[model samples]
Target chain A: MAKQDRAIRTRQTILEAAAVVFERQGYQAATITEILKVAGVTKGALYFHFESKEELALGVFDAQEPPEQVPPQPLKLQELVDTGLWFIHRLRTNLLTRAGVRLSMDQQAHTLDRRGPFLRWREMLLSLLDQARENGELLPHVDTSESADLIMGAFTGIQMVSQTLSDYADLEERYISMQRHVLPSLAVPSVLAALDLSPGRTERITAELAAVQD
Target chain B: MAKQDRAIRTRQTILEAAAVVFERQGYQAATITEILKVAGVTKGALYFHFESKEELALGVFDAQEPPEQVPPQPLKLQELVDTGLWFIHRLRTNLLTRAGVRLSMDQQAHTLDRRGPFLRWREMLLSLLDQARENGELLPHVDTSESADLIMGAFTGIQMVSQTLSDYADLEERYISMQRHVLPSLAVPSVLAALDLSPGRTERITAELAAVQD
Candidate 1:
């Protein structure tokens, strides 16, 4: 059992090290040698876990699954906002999330499953919006699927723009601006009024996640 | 005069050929040799026009100025919608525009000025929204700059999604859906009612531009 636990820990260390390299140099330019150096793991151990650079890239994408500690709210719209805020927070601080996004958007990453992360994000948003509609938090005519696409699309654009304009230093601000412009049209008046679309919401959510993890 | 005209034509040919290669192979992988072959131009001619591949990519970015034939409208909101539709139409048929967008989004093309096109787009949208606000076509609280960012962001996001999901075949429909969800919040009720948010608007705009060109 002790050996098994150490092996899992070694695998995680290697993945995190690879993510840092991928984030800095992108998928094509990133090398396993650098990852091995950063991870301080033997090449044998690295190859034992990940077969190739492509597999490591896929591992980064798989690591992008949203942290499971988002506490639910009675108001589904608030829950939606929390999801966005939580993601922005993670994207700001987490190398793995940043690498996942970078690899997915990398045009030269031909072998990577670039669409998977996008589809998963849309699915997550759709599920939340569906619940919002059922809770009467959404407007009467709101189509959850279309709304999900719009939200995901708008969020992506804002993030990209922020990256280009500010290297994501302004990501939280840009994200709040996106939600403010978009959420009003999808949520009911009361729900819109009750939702917290503050720029500081990411910090609050980050603290909550950290506390839960601790 | 004849020499000057010939030089202009040669430059145009090189740019078109470069766009084709860049669109197919992206910025980094695209070669000057491929562009020269595609253009059927001499190396001297290509070098006379563009000094390097980076210069060629920048030339592509400069060529992305929006078509000048979007006729003025009584309601600025309609004009804004027309601008977006016209872009989608051009993206559907024009190789240069497609290449410009692809290159701008290319993660590995770090030598290129990725933000120039985005800033230009936002500037164009801001000017129109400024007109819309002056004409009272926009809601009182609509901040033109923020709204411009949102419009540009959403348009980019929708185009990218369309590219991934349908190779841009459904871009017009997706763009219209985006406008329908977004414009209602930006435009005043009267202007929103008066605007044409139909999916076929791109076809109509394309026809209009062709007629003007003829």
Candidate 2:
């Protein structure tokens, strides 16, 4: 049991190091030597966990998905906002998520499949939208699937623009701006008014979730 | 004069070939040897024009901008849509624009300045949006700058999703869907009613612009 625990810890250390190198140097420019140096792990250990660079990237990509889901809300729209905010929070604060996102968007990463994150996001959004619609939070013409695509695209584009403009320092503000501009077309007036998409919402939600878990 | 004309033609040929290769193989995987083979030009000729792959990518990036502006519309909002639709049209049909767009979004392209297209696009959209607001086509509360960011982000995101899902075969419909979902938040009810954002709008607009030029 002790040896198994150590092995898991070692694997995690390597993944974290890979994320750092991949984020800084990009997937194509990132190298095993650099990752191994940063990780302080033997090549044998690295290879034991991940067969190749592609496998390591896949591991990093999988690590980007938040381990815990956002706690559900009574108003599905608020839940939707929470999900977006939480993702923004992750992008802002988490290196693993940022590196995973960078790798997913890297055009030079030809060997690794990049579609997983986008598809997963769209699915998650689509499910939430369907719930929002059933709860009477959506406007009459709001197609949940179309709105899913719109939200996914808008979120991605805003993040890219924010990254370019401010290195994601302004991502929360951008998210609020996105919600302000986009939600009007998808949600009812009452739902939109009730939604808490404020800049500090993520921090508050994270604290609430932490308190609940504790 | 003939010698200069040939030189110009050769340069154009190399750029076009580079665009094709870059689009097919992405920026990193794409090689000058492949471009040279496609262009059927000597190493001297290629070197004379573009000193390196990065310079060649820059050339392709500059070439992505539409040479002729969209013919103005009565409503600046219409003009804005026309610009977007025209870009969508180019993305669907033109390899140079597609390659450049791909390169602009390429994360591994460290040597190239990818911000030009995004900044230029925002500038163009911002100008049109400012005009639309001046003409009272916008909602009283709409901030043109925020709307510009929203529009840019949404447009980029939609294009990426569409490209991922369909390789851009369904981009026109996706563009129309985006306009439908997004326009209401920015434009006044009367302006929204008057706007022409239907499918096949790009084809009609392109024909009108071509006829006007003729």
Candidate 3:
């Protein structure tokens, strides 16, 4: 068990190192030797976990799993907003998330499944929207799947613009603005009125989650 | 004048060659030598037109100038929709535009000004929105700059998604859907009702433009 724990730690260290390199230099330009230098690990140790750079990129991409715990909310629509807000916050601060998104967008760089993250995000949003629909939150004309597609596409676009314009410093504000513009078309009038789609909601939610974890 | 025309043709040939290579391999992996080979031009000829690969990328970016001529419209809102529709048609058939957008999104690949195309697009949209406002086509609360940002961001996102999902086969449809969703918020109800945001609008506009040019 102790040996297994140590192996896990080493693997995590390697993944983080690769994420930093991939995020900085992109997949085609990043080298295993650079990752080794950043990780402070022997080539043997690095190869023991990830056989190739593609595997390392996949590892980084997979690291961006949806948060394991979501604080319960009174309304599913609020939860949806929280989900986006929380991700914007994470995308701003988390190198892994940023690298994952960057790799996914760099479709010509690798043979790995570039669409995985997008599909996963779509599924997650669809599930949430399904719940919102069940809760009578969606407009009568709203199609959850289409809305999920629009939300994912719009979010990806906004993030790209933010990255180009401000390196994501303005991500929270832009994401909130996006939600403000888009949600009115998706949610019923009453639900849209009740939902809190404000900037800094992610920070407050993060604090709440941290307090709960404590 | 003959010498100038030859120079112009040579430059266009190199730009097309570079666009093809960049579209295939992206910015980092694409090589000037490969571009020269494809263009069937001497290195001196290529250098006479573009100094370096970065300059070549910028040249491709600059090639995406808005159409010089727009058919006059009674409503600026219709003109705005026609602008996007015309772009969708060009983006479908134009390799230079494709290469420009690809390179712009490949943030780490080159030192070229990646934001030039986006900022230009935003400016063009802002001007159109300003015209729409002057014509009283916009909502009372509509901010032209913000609406321009939203339109640009949303269009980028929808295009990316369409590229990923269908290799742009459905781009026209997706772009039309995006405008349908977004324009209602910016335009007044009467104008929105009057606007034709249909999927086949691009083909019709293309035919009309060709007829006018002829």
Best candidate, lDDT:
2
Task: Name model 3 segments beyond 4 Å from true.
Answer: B68-70
Model 1 residue A116 CA deviation (Å) reads 0.5
Instruction: State the lDDT of candidate 1 residue by residue for A1-214, as single tens digits.
Output: 6999999999889999998887667676689999999999999999999999988988888767655568778988888888878887778778888878777777666566678878888998899999988898888888899888888777777777788778888777777777777787788898888888876676777787778789
Would candidate 3 be rated incorrect, acceptable, medium or high by CAPRI criteria? medium
Q: Rate the local accuracy (lDDT) of all candidates.
A: 0.82, 0.83, 0.82
> Candidate 1, overall lDDT?
0.82
Ten residues in a row with the worst lDDT in model 1 chain B?
B62-71
The C-alpha RMSD of each candidate to the native structure, in angstroms, is 2.2, 2.7, 2.1
* lDDT per residue as tens, model 1, B1-214: 6999999999988999999888777686688999999999999999988999989998888766655579788987888889888888778777888888878787667666788888889999999999999998888888899888888887888877778767788778777777878887788888889999876777787887789889
DockQ of each: 0.58, 0.54, 0.60
